[model samples]
Target: MLKEAVKKQLHEGTVIPAHPLALTSEKKLDEAGQRALTRYYIDAGVGGIAVGVHTTQFEIRNPEFNLYEKVLKLAIEEMEKGNTPDSFIKIAGICGPVEQALAEAEFSKSIGYDLGLLSMGGLNHLTEDELIDRTEQVAAVIPVFGFYLQPAVGGRIFTFDFWKRFADIPNVQAIKIAPFDRYHSFDVVRAVCHSKRNDEIALYTGNDDNIVNDLLTTYHIRSGDEKIEKKIVGGLLGHWSVWTKKVVEMFANIKDVQGEAQIPSNLLTLGQEITDANAAFFDSSNSFKGSIAGINEVLRRQGLLQGNWCLLEKEKLSPGQAEEIDRVYRSYPHLHDDEFVKANLTKWFDERQ
Candidate 1:
């Protein structure tokens, strides 16, 4: 069961970065680097950390790597050691079919994860009912954070019906709406607004492309004679993994202006700037083939990662991807947390000793 404090935190909204993998030059898990990255996120003031997710490389689940359990355990261990608040959420990325996802959910629950950020990436073979059935099975084990991952990154497009039915699942505490399409994004909002569990489900934007605006705008959905209102409270994004200190600050500013009639123009400009940076970090130019690598590259640059190596040998920065990352580094220095990571690097590493 989800803790009352943690559930309250999810509803209140907070930044939760899709945690990335840290690797050594030899293409092995860099345990020190991984711990340090966890430390980095906590110290950066993020509300939560999601491990074993897309940005952490789904390849970790392969038998050859067998890092799914290891990564999840390591992150939660670090989170506990960090003296995180009662509301600091620990999310485990749950994937695969029913049996596999169930096992993972059970293991995550055993290890103290508050929610499962369930991914439906490779389940395209299942019909919509089958998909919902799978979700119900997983939720029976642990509280779920439903993910509407964008298709560009191995995720299928879930329809409004799917989302509406998903919201009905009793244990679904939140949904990360990351279709990356405005219409699809709206579909989730409208579906939830119309659901019986609308108030119970907190909407978080996994739409890295529209983070700022997603948080600022309130959706007015006409449900029967009443106009129901909803908002994307926070983000669960890979784009946030890099520059997280700034992301936390930006989220705070966005929250401060939530009900204001006139948003400051600078927030709008910041949104575009963030999107521009995400394009470079997420490799939008290359169909996001290098999205994971791009995230690692930024961390490597900031000294949070030892090197930008993914478990899959073929996974590396795309052509001109590094140059684009450099461009964003130059273009938006304010978005980075280089100095924060630098100041605490040694201390974080020493704590692990």
Candidate 2:
């Protein structure tokens, strides 16, 4: 059961940035700088934040492990400048071996965060029994209000059936639902729902492109005149998206169609803008790692970020490529509410006209 206090206090909106902590010098920003970084994201309209410290990704860990405490302190300080703990869902991440997650989670819990995000994978993959053991151990101490485990990708979707077994673990509140591919993402949601597994578990679709469509619509698959109505799509997750605008709007739009078949018109419009830019961005980068780097650069130059170069890599977008992306960015209006914002809407509406 969702904690009464947690559920009651969950009305506020939260945002989780794809925590960027590239190990390179250029990408690494100090605690004060990171607090400033977090402030930018918070100012973008999130009531809370999810930060990671293990990888050069999202964690707030200072160079030393003890910084987790500092991260929490900084987050608290940053948030108090705008809101309170009850209004914020400050989630912290801890990833590594099972023992490491346990120790890290203990530290995170002590920091008094609203939630925790944990990750671990090694040696092809752990057996089902081992995964269950790990889940049991973690949830035992930490009030794992959520669990966003990545699917067995870079391997082959955990051979022992992770979805069913992991959901079986009590207090495993949710999963990020990152399919190795589109088909797998769709499959994971379908299987989870069909199996009635972890009925309360939130399914957060991390697949960027199809999120608006996939997490907002049910799938109708027919075979031999038999129609299967699947809620595999249209996830009722806690609204996690780093590729779009702020929370107040993101959650508002998603909640408008909770159980319905359609997303709000505005969301659809904004989603297309993302799709278009992603086309340009991805086309230039291609690799997932490269795509993140490219998008961060674009957001940085647009004055959306501090130009921390969140992802450090040997390759930088060529000056010509930078110009090309800026050209694409220019296509977007100053305010999302501008009349031109609905360019996609006009086209779609015209098709009906």
Best by lDDT: 1
**C-alpha TM-score for every candidate:** 0.98, 0.71
Off by over 4 Å in 1: 351-353
Report the error of model 1 at residue 295, Å. Answer: 0.6
Which stretch of 10 consecutive residues in model 1 shows the poorest summed lDDT? 344-353
Local accuracy of candidate 1 as per-residue lDDT tens digits, 1-353: 78888988899899999999988888788988899899999999999999989999999999998999999988998999899999999999999999999999999999999999999999889998999999999999999999999999889887889889999999999999998999999999999999999999999999989989999999999988989989888899999999989999999999899878999999999999999999998899989989999999999888888888999878889999999998989999998888888888898787544
Predicted structure 1, TM vs. truth: 0.98
Query: Best candidate per TM-score, number?
Result: 1
> What digit string (tens of lDDT, one per residue) describes model 2 on residues 318-339?
4455665666657864323223
How many pairs in model 2 have backbone atoms within 3 A of each other, for residues 3 or more apart or on separate chains, i.e. clashes? 8
Which residue pairs in model 2 clash with each other?
19-57, 19-58, 21-56, 52-58, 52-59, 53-59, 148-176, 215-234
Which pairs clash inside model 1? Answer: none
